[model samples]
Target chain A: MTETVSRCPVAHDQLPQPAPLPFVSEDPFHPPQRLGELRAEFPVSRLLYPGGEIGWLVTKYADVRALLADPVTFSSRNRQRANPIREMPEDFKEQPPKPGLFINEDPPDHGFYRKQLTGQFTVKRMKALEPRIEQIVADQLEYMAAKGPVADLVADFALPVPSLVICELLGVDYAERGSFQEWTATLLNLNSTAQQVRAAVDELDQFMLRLVKQKRAEPDDAMVSGLIEAQDGAERPLTDEEIAGIAFLLLIAGHETTANMLGLGTLTLLHHPEQLARLKADPSLVDTAVEELLRFNSIIRVGQLRVTTREVEIGGQLIPAGSSVVASNLAANRDPEKFDNPDELDITRGAVHHIAFGHGVHQCLGQQLARIEMRIGYRRLFERFPDLALAIPLADVKWRTDMAIYGLHELPVTW
Target chain B: MRVELERDRCCGAGMCVLYAPEVFDQDEEDGLVLLKIAEPPDSSLDAVRTAAGTCPNSVISIAG
Candidate 1:
């Protein structure tokens, strides 16, 4: 490649510069279409999104995956505010999150934040929650079976499991699921305006503020309450702001990501009835199938952003310090070079090395819990109503387009 | 099948054991995975593959 091809994609979008975004797609997730154009024409093209943000989008799997594992060269801190390729919301730009949330830190800081969460999701702790999670899955399916014939699988079953689990985890009141659900959904917006995003953040902040106050007064036993106690016993307990940020990150991340996965995953299976039947006939396949579902169509397209601390050459390109870089888990999972047949979905494909849950120092802290929830979800769902299938035609299903996370907003199904 | 653990990264989440008991047996104190077989048993390949796939650490390696 040439010098211009190697610099950031956004730099090439200046005025009077007639250049086509051959490798760039206006839609999210399908960045490959644009990437194809880029590789063929400007392999190192710059990207200046219409919103004034600019960054390089590493197109090939060799580039994105290799960069995510090497955190030292591609720093995580710079990614906290600017995700290089995507624009940062005004709310995030105005106020940086307190330092301990694992999603937004690098190395030593990342280690500290992750350590606090790591202790909570231990085998012992997750096993303890299994009975409760299984019960939740059954209750939802049972309720649906009773109301039978037709129901939206997403609202009735998929959405509740994760929401309730997060509620139980953080000790939030389940009765307020209405408001909490809204808060969880809006916080994950990828295309909403600055004012709208801030509004959502503000409401969520108020909700958390009230819960933090209640935890202080009661000091009951929950993640929040436990944190309060841990803080006291520690040589240095986290500040009130720190705890709030931690709660905010977990509550939002924990619930929405899994909930979307459950909804979209079931839909993916229902569409492929042969696979669904194969799984139902042999319940043992649920666990292996779940992994394939996660990899084949990872709900979250892009992993969290990483900033460069030093000049780094990744996938044959130089990413300077302060430049934003993101790992495309969707791309990595689908790399034809790695998997034998990358596009085909196979439930019995054995152990696939997928970065769907992510990899490296900041790998998903709650992945174990998500896996358990998914396992129980599919097992009970198929075992209980073996005939359950989609009510609407596969082509007509409404796929949410605005967000980076590709998920179905509603899944109408009937037995 | 031989079960492998990327011990460096395993956080003892115990998910492998919870999902598929036939394959993954855990150590009592440190909570690491202890395979039932030196390599994955052919009969238990399905369950073992599932257990290995769900492992968050990507530590489980099954070899016959």
Candidate 2:
């Protein structure tokens, strides 16, 4: 007889389980309340991705800043390896086929491209655009006024101003904005399927390619034309593909981020009636108010995902080499250590040091431009419609939790 | 306060000019930081300090 060994069933309940990872909050306007708990308890905690991949989610301000500043150890170049999004298609696993935009590049390459564009976004440059931006604001407000007492603030005013400004800057035809805007929306949407994203990218690439060729053929005064001229004059001219990539980046990031800020920022002010009154009473507060709003909202939820190139220690935790890390900008901006009473919206607070545009080498290139737009946008909007209020109840507002960038899907308003 | 700026280090984020326009300016060509007032008045000190502190590149400094 075969020796039958009686085996006792092991208790499944006795097995050790990993601590629950905080889900990225579906509410875009406010970060998950659990983030605060996580920040206090585990500044650097193990994050389990939807696809079962494990990575680190950095919550504290100091660690986030350190990670952003030290690019060599936490490389943005290898985002594919570090990105916790398991749904990202396999084709996107490699570096983009083209040289790609500077935001996605590392040191030398990043420096080269950034240097070329720095002049275009100077304080002086942005100030010069102020009149045009103001005009854009005025026109939008007029359009909204004509529309009625109630309107979608996003569609009527917020989206068009920046879209037109960026169009004028890039030399892209504004008439085609409807198509490109749709493409951009699809591209930035986190829920967009792989096929949908690819289709959008292909459309944008074709559009940019045609525009770049036009610039090469007849160099105009626009940024794309200026880039073409600069490259042609350089010792090594950039390829058409490279030019297209840059144009694509500018067109998409230029409009979407600022547009959201304007729409959501107005909504934020409407929420805080006292702050709105303060701003309305004193227009000069626009500068500091913009900064405060940026800090409070921090539209870019999870800033650029990075992967560790080498073994490193962060927030007293030892993360192994080749591990993925995500720095929460929302968390960092709201860190009590960084900001006084981080939750409250004080328009007077000159929170200049907030990492809303990010920090270190990859800090936002269009920040000044965005600032001017906000300062002017806010002052003009309120000045025109001092009694602006929400058309629907606050609870009825649709939040854009699906997109990579956090904002309201539609902010309806009445004045 | 005497303000000094390292123009070459300026990546043109424009915090200096934005905060203390009276003390700082930007080059038209490259948008690098340009010190307008080396020794600003006592009233401008706060603005100068804010500019130096807010500079993303840490290229601004003050002395005397």
On lDDT, the leading prediction is 2
Task: For candidate 1, write residues A164-232 as lDDT tens digits.
Answer: 998999998889889867765665555666576678877877787788888999987788888777776
Name model 1 segments beyond 4 Å from true.
Answer: A1-46, A59-62, A83-86, A89-94, B1-64
Specify the poorest-scoring 10-residue window by lDDT in model 2 chain A: A1-10
DockQ, each predicted model: 0.19, 0.52
Error of 2 at A298 (Å): 0.5
DockQ of candidate 1 against the true complex:
0.19
Candidate 2 deviant stretches above 4 angstroms: A1-28, B1-9, B36-43, B61-64
Q: List each model's interface RMSD.
A: 4.4, 1.4
Best candidate, DockQ: 2
Q: What TM-score should be assigned to candidate 1? A: 0.81
The residue pairs in collision within model 2 are: none
